[model samples]
Target: MHPGRLEGRYVAVVGPADDARDVDLARAEAVGRALAEEGAVLLTGGHHGVMRAAARGATAAGGVSIGLLPGSDRAAGSPEHTHLLPTGLGELRNGLLVRAADAVGAVGCSWGTLSEIALARRTGVPLVLLDPWDLPADAGVVAADAPAAVRAVVGLLAGR
Candidate 1:
């Protein structure tokens, strides 16, 4: 709740890595790039699909991309992530991600993504949407694409 915590705060990116032909990976990439250029860290599930795409985009911009893994094992780490946070809580690692972020970018959503989005809202952080529907209004939802998500988060960081 402190001012400027979001200035360079981490953004939690929640999505499914099971789908190889997902429809929203592009949006995730755009969101990641935007966050990176703004100098914010990107946090993810540490695998493929949306997570890998976002990590790649962020790392390409020279920003840090971190993966929070379940069960304390990182053998499946996405190559783009520079750090891995192994919580050993399996799916419950979602809580750690929600705790670490100043905001949330809910993209390529699935059952797991929905859980993360809901938890983030419960935590009272801002949220940007790429999957668009089924999110809480209390989350300060950003309705635009990835670029807009980044802009919204940056504005929040600036206290605008």
Candidate 2:
């Protein structure tokens, strides 16, 4: 989408961009789709695996999706991203992912995803988990189902 049309409203979606083979990627993608269906923007690492799937879900739902690339070169972007942000900071790129988003959503449990969850929690951003094994004691635990998680998060976003 045109960059001008997408601004102010953004939701940073953080998850494992490297676990496409080991885990069920469809679940993560479904979570992303749920986010998009709710009309919030989607954000991610902007590459393969979870990021790509999430981007696809958002786009399929007609929601804006942005990718915060970890490298300076633009070749790292996934096909589903609506906007590309190239940051040559490698793993440090997680910081940008966490900060740029108004709220954060986590799907899989991997190292990168864990870091993102930590960052989001530390930043005091609203967060939702699709299959969270562990989370803050006071986190509003939504149902494990994708639709329920989406509804819960959207309600949180809407202050419901």
Task: Give the best candidate by TM-score.
Answer: 1
Tens-digit lDDT string for candidate 1 (98-144): 88888888885777888788787777777777655555566556556
lDDT of 1 at 108: 59
lDDT of 2 by residue, 115-148 (tens): 8888888878888776765767655344576666
Candidate 1 residue spans exceeding 4 A from truth = 1-7, 20-22, 135-139
lDDT of all the models against the reference?
0.77, 0.74
Q: What local lDDT does model 1 show for residue 112?
A: 82
Error of 1 at 122 (Å): 0.8
Task: List runs of model 2 lying over 4 Å from the truth.
Answer: 1-8, 21-24, 139-142
Model 2 vs. true fold: TM = 0.84
Clashing pairs in 2: none
* Per-residue lDDT of 156 in model 1: 61
